[model samples]
Target: MNNHVAPRAAGKQVFITGAAGGLGAAMARMFARHGAKVFLTDIDADAVTAVADEINRELSDTVAWAATQDVRDEAAWIERLDQAAKAMGGLSVLVNNAGIGSLGSVEQIELKEWRRVMSINVESILLGCKHALPYLREAQPASIVNISSLAAFKVDPDYAAYNTSKAAVAMLTKSVAMDCTRQKIDVRCNSVHPAFVRTGIVAPFYDALGEEEATRKLTRGIPMRRLGEPDDVAYAVLYLASDESRYVTAAELVVDGGACAI
Candidate 1:
């Protein structure tokens, strides 16, 4: 089998959220490397700017830009996306990768924490789709990839808020896809469900249990017996964002290590 990955996203203009580090940063780099211009955003102004600078420096060109954004804020979404579309000349891909995880069983979790998780993980996607649709529709053949999680399907009792929010995202993706298709729009929407990727989101697991033990514990249920790399999920996002998946929408692309199978 040939292992070469083609530059499938050439000429695509991508907007990624939570792009300071981890999967968001990885996706931004992958898109830039594969010939797409990426506009990255995160709440951390300094870190996101640094990430954009690092990518430009590495590529020796300005294929990437960064801005500070709070995904839960509708006004911020409108402003940031407008700036990004202007910077990139157009926006063809919007990756809703910004999200937060909440730990605690339903009974233990407070209302504020639940709302926080929902606002970031679920409502943000709604806002992104609502606001980005105009730009995406103008760019036709555009795509929106929402970063959900395996927990959406395979739930963990302690992560009640996170599980509920991601599940909502999966359904919301389908709703958006249906709306676009019903209107004969070329914009596509999809959700990615990744299992235990090596990003800051999972850093707590390593901190709670040292890396060695954490890896073993986390991998015990995974058929591949390993944690996923950032690129593993990034590649999935790349496919969904690129024209390669022009016909794929309202789909959940699972990047799990066969954990969801059983």
Candidate 2:
């Protein structure tokens, strides 16, 4: 408990996936900083542990912990979320942030690869929402933040699998949100669409396209003419997670730098 830390998320129990680095880690850090007890899970156990350790080291009291999870595994989702709920007393937020980058279009991609991409990017959302609902409702005023991508709306031929997978997430978020509301569940559901944040996720694109062309392509038609930061997305999640966005659900927050506007 840093004396200066504002407890915007005080008493919140947050479970985050793919939290070893990049956007997931950023969200974990911000949530913990705002006084949420966060369970940072990832397939990379050691890396997630390091992230939790880093956050705990900075805070006066323990606010973040780590777990290993294969988000694509439905059984793993059930077990890991139960363990996280037990550790946190209950869960108030679920950030289904684990995903991967897939290259190649429908014309070139293998069936196996498309399944792999959808399994990670889209299936994980379904599993997390399904498995975490009970605990989230118990914690009332809870939120499920799905980390979709702008590719969901601005499709590229080369990013066929990735775009399609994110599109599924986009629609899934709305479906879950509506279902929760209709059922009188206290949980909120939303998706974030961030364009090409400067995370390592873009490393593959840069390597594939070469630096100059990749940069140009990524920023093309963007009014900001710049990439976004993980914190930019995390801030949006914070607003949605807190009581401020209590009435906001079944929504998609576009964190892209106006790239989608054009």
Best prediction by lDDT = 1
The local lDDT score (0 to 100) that residue 125 gets in candidate 1 is 95
In model 1, the clashing pairs are none
How high is the CA lDDT of each candidate model?
0.94, 0.90
RMSD of each predicted structure: 2.0, 2.1
Across residues 1-262, which tens digit of lDDT does each residue of candidate 1 receive? 1248657788999999999999999999999988899999999999999999999999899999999999999999999999999999999999999998889998999999999999999999999999999999999899999999999999899999999999999999999999999999999999999999998877888999998999999888799999999999999999999888989999999999999999
**Candidate whose TM-score is highest:** 1
Query: For candidate 2, lDDT tens digit of each residue in 159-255?
Result: 9999899999999999999999998988899999998798887787799999788888878867898788889999998888887889899899999
Looking at model 2, report the run of 10 residues with the lowest lDDT sum. 1-10
Report the error of model 2 at residue 167, Å: 0.8
Off by over 4 Å in 2: 1-6, 204-214
TM-score for candidate 1, please give it: 0.96
Per-model clash counts, in order, read 0, 1
